[model samples]
Target: MTQKYRSRARNLLHLGSTQANENFNQMVSSKAPKARHYGGSSSLMNRVSATVLQKNEGHSYLAKDLESIPDPIKLQNFNDFVTFDLETTGFGYCDITQIAASVGSSKYQSYVYPRCQISVEATKVTGMSHSIATNKLYLHGKEVQGKCIRTALLDFIDFLKEKDQPILVGHNIASFDVPILSRLLKEFGLHREFVRIVPAYIDTLKVARKVFSKEEVNGCYKQCNLVEVYLNIKYDAHVAVEDVNSLQQLFTVKLKDKCTDEDVYSITCKSCKESYTDVIKNKIVSKVICEKLSKDGIALQHLQLANRRDPNGLRVILREHGVPFKKCEDLARKIQEE
Candidate 1:
């Protein structure tokens, strides 16, 4: 182990797992979700410290010997990044069921109780049945699982903070994962904490879609799903940790020699700009529709009749006025689908 992780492991041992696990279990079992104080910065730092220490037992997925592993950054073309993936309950208005992330040599994975039943369609895609998600378990390296979203996110926040906010990389994370996480944090009153630790996101889905848009599988264009992009590669799908591992491999293999570091950074910036600009356009469209609604007396009358009671009626009015009645974020996603 490197000096840094060695120091972290020692600090974690000082905190003692017995007490931490007890407190963590109590917090998760409670019916009402509460903001995890984590006993302020010092206590939180201990948890982050412990995150680096893997169980001493042998595990298939863990680094065979931590000391033997090279510096993760030097090995990678891009060093400062955490490749993460989340398995969610469903498409929209969903809760994250599993969260997995990798930064440097440390990897984290946990099943998150969404606090809502998983949908059939979601279960079909992720294979995360309600029972499997709710049960306490372990990942390949004896990594504990069955943390509530609040706990999972709180720990994730600490991990990011400890890592100095590395770039977030994942498939379709910009449009789906980040937004979904933002909404959940808002619901749990941790949105500010999440925003405070926010890092630039590199949506590999966007990169792959742009780079391989014309690539066909069986004479049909392939989707930007992580598995689809690397279909021939042997790896488990829907399992967050496996997916993240595959994502990193896919990125390194596809992009290593294709573009210089500067070229990659430039492309990343352009992609981010295009995404933001589309959002701005949608906001402008929303404003235009609202302004028009304010001026049209007849439409205003119809809006008032069912106004607060009937949201669909308002949508119809907006549609009639040649305005799409979707929120800015929704509109941006719709534009992406085109």
Candidate 2:
């Protein structure tokens, strides 16, 4: 069937089957890993909860809410931007089960004890359980998962500490890795303000969709799985470092010369004094804005992916509604320039 038809089928028959809604969560958690537990629709971020960003009530309600280094933006000064990933008990409400990151030239992968029972389903694929990998590597005990995720996360932050901008890049990172890592970081005292210092980021998934083609969105929504995108490139772990490596490789193997090469170099971020690519910088600004604009509750539950609005369309939306959008837009534009 066409991607469109398949999506239609999924939506009509089982769109909310695995959602974090009361009924679905109750049913799924019964079989899924207990650690992978998720709260449901109520736990999601509003804007990301659904595709609808606005309503035409003749107007609409409001809402809010990466990557590469070129040669010019290389990590010449500061530490590396540390590419990473997390294999959670479940995508929505489930807790983090395994965390993996690429540190420098090597790799760091950990199967964390989800502070609670991991769901049965989560174990089938993730191969994780309550006793999974204890003493196998650096670990955060189920009890310590909350206390030390941020500390264990420091392994990632340290690598990004160079004079250059530490740019964290990964596949599906903006939605998955960053949020989880940020939550853990806050628990560790990094606080909200210091996040800006963590270097820039890039989600190859986002970049590919925005800058390249996204007919691939079909596989899950309408066409092909991520594997289809790089049918030639083999991916193993479905885990972090490997996925990041796969994504980083995609830019090279698939895009070849089309992708940014040495021409664009990393510039040092004023704050970190670390070198990071311009491409990564752009994503950082975009992310910062998303955090600023995101509406509470709903946006978290949905895990929305905010898109860049065209200035002209934005002007029209603001002018017509008499909202203080211009000022906000001005700030975004300023950040964009920096």
Model 1 per-residue lDDT at 325 = 39
- Model 1 TM-score is 0.49
lDDT by residue for model 1 (259-313), tens: 3222222112222233344435655334444443322212222333433545554
lDDT of 1: 0.54
Give every collision pair in model 1.
none
For model 2, give the 10-residue run with minimal summed lDDT. 295-304
After superposition, candidate 1 runs with Cα above 4 Å error: 1-79, 131-144, 216-232, 256-338
Name the lDDT value of residue 30 in candidate 2: 46
Candidate 2 per-residue C-alpha lDDT over 67-90 given as tens digits, one digit per residue, 9 for 90 to 100: 111112333333444556676766
C-alpha lDDT of residue 58 in model 1: 21
For all candidates, the clash counts are: 0, 56
lDDT of each: 0.54, 0.43
